[model samples]
Target chain A: MSAQDTVLVVGAGPAGLSAAATIASMGKKAVIVEKEDVLGGAPIISGYAKLVPSGEWAKDAIGRMVSRVEGDGNVSIHKSTKVTQVAGEAGNFTATLSNGDKLDAGAIVLGTGFTHFDSINKPEWGFGTYEDVLTTTQMEQMVGTGQIRCPSDGRVPERVAILLCVGSRDRQIGREWCSKICCTVSTNLAMEIKEISPSTDVFIYYMDIRTFGLYEDKFYWKSQEEYKTKFVKARIAEVTKSPDGRLLVKGEDTLVKRPIVIPMDLVVHAIGMDPNALNPEIAKTFGIGLEKHGFIDRAEQYTNSQGTTRKGIYVCGSATGPETIDDSIAQGQAAGSRAVADLYGQQKVAS
Target chain B: MAIHEKTLIDPDRILQHDHLVVDGVDVSGSWNTMITPRTLTDYEEHFEEIIQSYSGGENVHRCWQCGSCTNSCTMYAQNVDFNPRYWIYLIRLGLKAELMKDKDIIWQCVSCNKCTNICPKDVRPEGVMKATAHWLEDNGLTPKTLSTHFDEEFTHQCIEFGRIEDTEVMVGFFKRSGQPLVQAWIVEFGKRLTKRLPLGQLAKMGMNVVFRPKTKSWGKTGEVLAEYVKAQKEAAHHG
Candidate 1:
């Protein structure tokens, strides 16, 4: 393929890998620029345990995608590097990489995914104050290692409380969008915890269980019925250490119409997704726009689902919003096809 | 005046000290009063299943605790404590002790089916209320309510005669509950009935009450109903 046939794909997570694979299948070259040393973005880099909907371990699932793109001859990988600057229009653009490499590309596809909400932001939940309090990422790491124990003493916790929507849907925190996937992920985690330690009781506290569509029976109901995981309809108010050393979760049991303080051995924040940290910089570099939530803004969703505010510049996955892994991958392919279509269309115009 | 509802805090949880000191500072008086931190741990894991064993309670497990039941309940308009949603939550979580707190008022459900009609989960919370009331009585946590007594009396009348004798039911219920039958309201109702009725219809009604009339077509139906009820009661108790 000619140099102008090359596509610059940013972020080598599930979406980036799929985008690169799609570009390669179209007989075009794809230069994947990943900021991290690893390929499979958050799932592999953040050390996620098991993915939702599919019980496949994160390493195994994302690993397969990484290997597929890695084996393709038309795809070139760039690790620990970023696109520093972009110049010229969509049809003929020059991208300057952080490593002093310049690349010519006809189009750009951003698959930069989201960052996990830090539990430290919500100190009232006792994430930073208490040792047993952990974020979903840390809890996923614990589950990954097959040792679900208190971080402070390494003791097996008898009761664990997972608080959902830690960073999302709270106007106080200025994050009003629902983080879509946490409900199903929390339910899946509850089941996994029960499988590893049958004696431990898992309680998920949430304002709403948004395990939408088919996930209702698969995760939410199954967790209750088979695993005996309890789901409480309450947004936890505060988490404090009890006089007896266990963490006390204070909340109004909305259904019971009573304020309850339950002692738990461990408390987990089922954290939400935030816009990628590099979003503003990426928007500036690519000369695109950032949406209100600081995600990459879309140009027109109806005509071009993957189109960014700038022509021939596509955005997909969690970079646009809180997106699931499977949806992100699908969006990645759409973006790749959009880039290919635009590049061919430009070529025809030139001819 | 607005109705005074019971506070969620148990009286035992409130602690007051005549004299108090903290951090070498005498923060007496109002500062001395404290509410002890209370945590619930005595959850019966199979409480939901137990409730489901009763007739009309088979779908208790399906409730997502949406509060629609409580929001639309007829009795809730009168007393907020009469919450079917709250009871369903307690049952789902197996918080038997938490559920016991509302035992006195659970039988107050008016069987309006408003909650059941409005529920999006098809939880049939009206049935859950009935089942919970029955469960409360069956477990001996609560005494048989007046409504339960009346229901039993009405059912007995229906099965024995293959029809209902309203006067017999009222007398049977009053006798079972040890209430005086010659109440002011009953006397007034009898006077109204006497004033409004034709002589022949009035005589027929008086004869039915005196003779305790039975339907001629009611052969094995009464025995079958009684046997079915006995079998259902046994199943509920065992389950």
Candidate 2:
């Protein structure tokens, strides 16, 4: 296919890169635009530490995926560029790049991912005031350094508290939607923490530990049984600093209706995800709709996870909704196949 | 009184409390969490403005008493009862009495704009605070300590001189509020005591405050302000 028939993909994260790779393998040109100076989004920042299904290292799998996508010659990667304006009808869109360059494409796929809810938004959590209180993203960065030490004293924490549902399932704050990935991600991090520092005590405060689908057994069992991570079915009401420099967590044991106060050396806020700020910008530019939660709105849930109301405008990965890397890759391939089918049908009609 | 069927609930037999209460009836219990359904009639006049100000105020009615806003607010970092979300919920249900009950908190908003900024929907929480404050002031339910002092000071000064005299206003506020005069004029007193006052003529300052120049149109301006207030009250009634 000629370069003019190329598919424009925004974002070079897991989903965008996967879609580009899939399109290139099908002998179609894929032009990928990434706002970041380098490819790989959150995953590259603090490399994945997930438990692979094959019991292998997660870094290996991510490395392989990155190499495969980068090796493709049919894909033209443009870094530090974004689609500022998107106009024209489906099957023919003219996207104006931020650099005054324009690109014509028959189809476009959006894989712009999500951003972590700023922990400072919930200041009562004592995120900035207390050195021991850190968000999950900050914890990930510390883990990336291969050592977890209290920033205040540079000592391993004797008791670590992980508070869940920081921004999820909160109706009073108006964030009623549950950020699906927090449970599994927190559980994984808890387990890793325990394995690294066996002597350290880990307590997870949650309204309910939601481990859905195939992830249920591994996350719930491994964290609770194997690692012996204490699970408290309660919502943390307050986080304060103790006079002795320890972090104090207060919550109610809902079953007994009694308040529980626990002191810890460190507190980790398992903060949830929020829709990217650019979701609305994308919706307005492409004439696509957004759901009430600010994610790109699909025509329907079952049949149109990646399909938008406008033709030739598709969305995958967290741009559509909260999703995992595996799910994002699957959605990318699906969107790629859908674009190819549309192109092939048009060619047949023209011939 | 019930002698027809001879229905007996024996002391030795286990008695069920469910039998005492019937369907759709209020049961006497220690927990009075059952919320009374309130009518929006009292606020029906300003309902359109309130709704428009709060972006329809329909979404706020969906609050399930989750107390997320209370738990999430930074202002609550200092005061727990100062809940922005709860006030919005109360407004949605048109619980004007409850809205008036928390008059102090209605105005305590620091305007950090975080609550609305973090709202999942564009609820515009700051607007809710403004609406609640307006509702309270309209009903004359302002807090005694805070609002009364402010209103008394403003009205007294305005009536005495037809406009506010800043220095006199400060002195009157301190005297009426029963605060120490020393505390009120601590800085001014210190400047005078230290002999570090400005190198300007004291006569100019005295003329500016005590012998302040009067406007030729002062009477007309006062008449115009009174007319404006009257028009506002009439429009509010018609609305």
Candidate 3:
């Protein structure tokens, strides 16, 4: 495929990889420009133990999509390259790579996904201060390493408390939007921890379980009934350390209207999704708009959920907002088809 | 007129005209319901400290007013006015006057331990209720309610004998609380008790009241406990 037939894809996460595959399948070249050397994004960087909801090993699940994109010769992998500058119109554009390589494409897909909320912003959570305090990503890394050890003593935790909405849905921190994936991911992690160490009691403190639709039965129900992952309906106020060096999860049991302080060997903060720090630069590069909360603003969320305010530029997956892996992949494909249609306005097929 | 919804305003303080005009303003709409401006001059700056001085109210300072306590409260289920969360909020803010409005129902906490078990901040609202009721009595905002009298009578007997004869406690509590000792329920219970108990057991009960059962080595323990309690109570009220 010539440079004229290629589509520029920024970010090599699930969204970018899926978009590359979809574009490649349409007989159009996909040039994936990733800042990182590796392609699989968080799942690979954090070495996620398994994809939540499905329980598939991160390598196997994301690897399949990665392989599909890599298998196609139409996909060009630009490793450790960043799109420093972009210019031109819908059907004819040039993106200058960090390596001084210029790539010309018909359209651009800004699937530059999201950054995990830096739990350090919430000092009350003790995320970085205490050794026992771990973010959901850190916890997943520990689980992936085949040893869920406490950061304090390097011993397997006897009990763990997973707190939901650490950054999301908290007005104090100014993130009122619910990070759509944390609840299901937290519940899933609770169950996984239970499975890994049955003796390790897992407690998930949540205000509301947002395991909506299909995940209601698969993740939430199974975590509760089958795995016995204890769900406490309370948003934790703060995490303190016990005299014995264990983490103390202070929260009210909303159901019983009483304060509960649970001592835990490990406290996992299911930190919500935050827009990537590179969002402002990327938005400026594409001449697109940013949402109130800083995600790439879509032209019309109800009608065109993935279309950016800029004509040929689009965003998908967590770059727009927190989304599941499946939703990211599907939206990637949608962006691919939309780009294909936009690039070839008068024609239906690649021909 | 832009209306300010004063949810916390005193109903009696609100001056609403029935069929008259206010200085030719003809406030005929719902705007006619005018709330009297309030100047809160009764905030006890250290009131939360006093609440925390009580055993159950020790964690009251940790409360963020999530309303979980009120939602889970057994009393709140029956009477919505029985709100532990609201009282905790008032106490934290030192709105002593606002807190006093719910003084009558504060003592109705059933000591269910539900509030204690579920408090995320471990406010132990059940204990806060007990402490608050005591605080009210200590401050003389209200007289010693029946529940306080019963508690005092029970504690006084326990301290004196180190053990309470069941009948003695009942008769003592009833007497202290100023309830008729010959109530219909008590009469029925006594009749049933006599019917169920053999003569020997009944005699044992009579002997217990006469001799007054005592913990064998509880001589100085009760005295020490009573003295410590009195000191703590003094400190709680004055310190």
Candidate 4:
């Protein structure tokens, strides 16, 4: 195939894998460069428990996507590599990989995804201070292992408190946007916790239960109705230790109109998403603009939804903003189609 | 929190045609109830501040009405109309007329603190309940409730003797509320208590009731507390 027939896909997450698969299916060559040694992105890398909407294990679900791209002959995979530089215009471009490999591509699809908000920034919530306080990711790992025990000691937690919006929607932390998935994920985790240890009572403290779309009844209501997980409308102010060695979640129970300090065996922070840490460097390397929030800037959403500020360069998934894995895959496919069409359109004009 | 509750819709506004046919379609009873749209104009702009002027209602302005208070409410479980979230919404919107609709039940808060304990915004809905109930009585919209009368009697005992004389407090409550002291429930309760108690303990209780117990160190403490309470009440009312 000519250089103009190849599409360079960045990152090997759900979005990137789908993008490459879509490009290959469209009868075009796809060069996928993933910085991580392994593929499947956050879900597989982070070892997420079970995906929301579908209770399938992250490994099994995202693994299928990985195998599809890996099995495709039209796609060339480069692991532990970065696209260091992009030179030339749209429909004909050259990309330099970190592994000293050079690639000629017609268009690029960025599916770099996002970084899970680190709970250490919000010190008062006690991620680092208390051994029992864990992030949702860490809790998911425990769920993946099918072991629900307090990290402080090898004891089954009697009560687990899942605090939502730990990193998102907090103006104090400067992360004003909703992370979008945490509410559903937290509810899913709550049910998982109840399932693993039926005796353990799980309480999810949320500002607003934004299990949007179909996820509302499936995750939120199901967790409450089926699993018997309690949903509290209190955003915890602080997570402290009680005299009895149990974690203390301090907050005003707005319903009861009283400041309450509830003791828990485990406290989980439903950490939000932040723009991928490598976004600035990626934007600079790809000659793309970054939005004010630091996600890749979309040129115009109306006509070209996947088009980044730079023509022939498209952005999808959490690299643009906080997006679900399923939506990101759809966006990846959309970006792939856009890249292929733009390249073919250029060739049609040239011919 | 649900912004629009079923209770907010007045029964009068809901018109259901028993038998009707419209445009070749037969629209029957209850399926299609036409609710007249309510247009509110008499909103007190400073209603939130007015509620804030009362104790416990100070944080009434902080309510985002997430319904956590109502969801975990002890009173709401008993009566759906006892919705703290909806009342808070009305208070915030300065819907005085709408609020008056639920004035009778507002004083029925069991003080369970469930709503306050679960509220995300620290909108102490329990305190708001107490404040709202007190506001109603202070404005003469509601008569002093039996609960308020009981509270006054209990407070009177505490101030006079630095202790609660349960029998005196109950008698005082009945007197203030214009209820007969020899109620059937009180008689049944006395019979149960006598069955559970020994003769010696019963005699001691009778002696204590006859001669009201007083704390020895309560010298002038009652007067100080009474004066402080008076001043605080005056400030809260007028300030």
Candidate 5:
């Protein structure tokens, strides 16, 4: 494998696109395959400003990467295409694409990100049963549309309840792993909703408030002090529909050991993320391995987060594990450098 | 709300003793020596053997006693003492007497299958509940109210008719339970008036339940079920 060798990257999200841009910058032929008609994956669907380290807009960061990759002649992007079949050995594999086209690659990187956990599985959350109850994704769309009205009545909600950990940290539902990002995302949404509608009451039911790193003080102060969002430390037991079309949320205040039922005009389930549904298919097709929890298993945590068990194949971002945008970008760059090192037989570039 | 006064154990004093006795029973075991050993060794042994017999029951030993299953149970949503996880734990720990005390809770399951679906490790908590119910029936530990009327009536109806006739089953159930038989007719009449009778929607309810078809080989199926139970008992004894 050389600089002229083509490296195929699956997915066009931050991780895949970052890898493509990095590879092209290093003068390698990089090809990106995206299943969606447009790029940006969940971010576009979410319609939120990405949280950068410097509090900069995520679009600006993503726009820079997209320009670099698209401007480079070595990088070829294939939208509305999926890799149907992967065959051959490491360093000389063939990917049979969806359009009956085949591409030969010296190295491959899997960055097919995670899918949102289906909140309806937790039926007690009243996700599908109540029209007023929406998912975090749906809430984002509402905010994007510049109105936060109850889906049932098309009226501005006077009382809103956001339930955290709908599909995360719940052993009874079998998803014990912490989704890590939902806390900050929910807290941020709560603040935004309050800023838009100051009189609207927002209550967040959470098992625990996990605001890790620099976002910790910001999340805590904003929700607790600034926005005055009522934080209740309890896991919701059930969400029922009231005769008036409001959602009746029931849960025990763990500290008080007493049940509390609050009626709200609207409810939001901050659902977690699971490994992409295509993870198993990709693992079998590429001879990679999956963890017990179904995410692609990295070879080692410390030294090989990007590298999988198979040689010449690297995995990064949410495909390997749950991560924020900052972590995904860093891992993407590292994976690109690692793939380059594997091809060139030297670690010249600082990842 | 009023807080009731009760005898309080000194936490410091209890920590000093390696073993504690509750009502003349030894509490010392592999993990918690402070609590009384409510489970018997023989019962624990048999429960483990039965669990090991089923592929789905293999995760029974992985219970960390977190009480998450019991806390999240839909049955417990209605009844406070109907803790399925605790019952399963009792079975694992060989607390047969404690398990037998809550036999009614075993059948109270609506089979919502929510517990198994939400189990973090794919523990199949519902299967454990079913296994416990089956174990109670095999051991004859089911309460008289549950076994004498409900179980006997259901078993008799299935064995004799191959399928249960709702009206006949209700009448038989009421008669055996010392209730009046005419009550069943009143209920049936009320159901018929509301167009809720099963026989009325025979075509929609599926052919098996609507027609009440007799099993061609009822005897064979009964024999197979009996043999399976006997084999399980033998294995439990050896185990």
Candidate 6:
């Protein structure tokens, strides 16, 4: 096949899957590489409960993307692999995968999505120390099991506190960007816990609730009016343990200028998204620029949201920044279109 | 002020410069005052313990300072100075002098239990308010507030008669609070009560006052409870 025939897509998450499917529909070969043995990304492996806006089951939503890419003959998914090496620039590139397979493609798309911020980094949150102390990923896994219980004793959690911005938006830790999804996720998880067990009092402590846009703001308000979930305006300072294995969260209620201490059965840290670790290696291989925060910078963020600093190579999804699944898919389609357009011009020249 | 918590800078720590430049940058403004950092050594140790010794201050230590109590406080609505969460914080830190700033209004809590009902940490701030008020009087930090006088006199009746006599509680409370029983409002209220009530109902109310209602089975429970209260007070006092 010619260099313009196949479009290389990295990672098999929603972004990569959508990119590959879009390229495949354009009658071009699409190759996808993932670090894990699974097709879906972090959400699939961690096991999410529900998607926001529509509130669809994450399993079914992600399953649809998996099937779309799997059914396409033009698309090839290489699971349990990663891009080990890349050569050439822009329109023509050769990538050597961890599986030792090489591919010559017209354009490259890095859809390597973000990973959850490690809660261990913020020791004050007491993430790994307390069995009942969990991050959103762990809480999602627990929620998948269909029971809200203290991880320490397996007893039902009478009270659960979700603290937002665990690792994000804190100048002390060098992360000044908002993760953008924690507010919605924390709210949804609180609602889910309350729905699963009505007796459970779910409290969310946030510096500010940024349920941006139309849909997410509705869910936040609905949490207060419909679900009766309590939103406390206190960024918790510390999580200490009680004598009875319960967690004590300490923070001042900024609204009342009062200090509060409450014992909780479980403490869920709504950790934010950090740039994927593979970003540095990928940037090194492809000769692209990464922002100070480690995510790839857009060539022109306003006009070319998916276009990276390097020509022919593009980026979509959380590879560039914190993005929802829907946004990742949209970026995937845009990257596919950009790749196909570049390849089409080259194909005409070759003919 | 580079400080995130502006309120944390107490009044004494404020340092205002009339006309000063720091590293060639003029930092003279109404809002740009600096704080003089000072190590605190005047914390009232055992303040939390003493408050906890009272009826409702048991969970004061559990307070992480979320301010939910003050946010939902009924008294705070009337006057922002009526802050339960702030007092709880001061009690925990043993900031006795800082707490004394709001001594008079500490007893202004309406006992609405809004703070307690909405407290995420179960701080039971209504109880804390009473406890703090009692603490203030017990320590002679302030004179007995009307609420404290009312509570003590009411509790005395309960300890003695097993139940509260509304009339006796009112009379005892007014006398202890230094308010005359026959005030203009009280006489008007009494006139309204007497004008609206039938003679038979009035007679029954008078008879009930003469022979106070006693719990038939509260034979030794009252004495036991009174003794228990006394022991608790002694323990707290010793602390």
DockQ of each: 0.23, 0.01, 0.02, 0.02, 0.01, 0.03
B1-239 in candidate 2: lDDT tens per residue?
22222244322232334234436665535322232222121222234245434322323433333455556677889987787766654554344555555677667877777766666545556656655565556566774575567667876556444677666666777777787777746877767855965646555656768776545557666566667767886554333
RMSD of each predicted structure: 7.8, 26.3, 14.7, 20.7, 26.3, 12.9
Which tens-of-lDDT digit does each residue in B55-97 have in candidate 4?
A: 8887776665568988998888889989999888778756687
To one decimal, what is the Cα RMSD in angstroms of model 4 from the true structure?
Answer: 20.7
TM-score of chain B of each: 0.56, 0.46, 0.54, 0.55, 0.47, 0.50
Candidate 1's C-alpha runs over 4 A off are A346-351, B1-58, B71-80, B94-98, B109-127, B144-234
TM-score, prediction 5: 0.58
Candidate 4 Cα misplacement greater than 4 A, ranges: A346-351, B1-239
Off by over 4 Å in 6: A346-351, B1-239
lDDT assessment of candidate 4 = 0.86
Residues A1-351 of candidate 5: C-alpha lDDT, one tens digit per residue = 342388888887888888887787787888889898866656764565535234444456666767777788988989899999888766677889999989988788877889889987998888888888898888877776667788987888887889998888878877878888888888777877887777776778888777799777577546644665666666888898767677788877564344567678899999898888889888887889999888888876576558887877888788976788778777878788777666664533223
lDDT of 6 by residue, A188-241 (tens): 888889888888877788888888886454777667545656666678888889
Ranking of candidates on TM-score, top first: 1, 6, 4, 3, 5, 2
Q: Compare the candidates by TM-score and give the number of the best one.
A: 1
On the 0 to 100 scale, the lDDT of residue A184 in model 3 is 90
Which numbered prediction scores highest in lDDT against the true structure? 1
True contacts kept of each: 0.31, 0.00, 0.00, 0.00, 0.00, 0.00
TM-score of each: 0.77, 0.58, 0.61, 0.63, 0.58, 0.63
Who is ahead in DockQ, 2 or 4?
Answer: 4
Runs in model 3 lying further than 4 Å from the true structure: A1-4, A347-351, B1-239
User: What value does the lDDT take at residue A118 in candidate 2?
Assistant: 79
Model 3 chain A lDDT-worst window of ten? A342-351
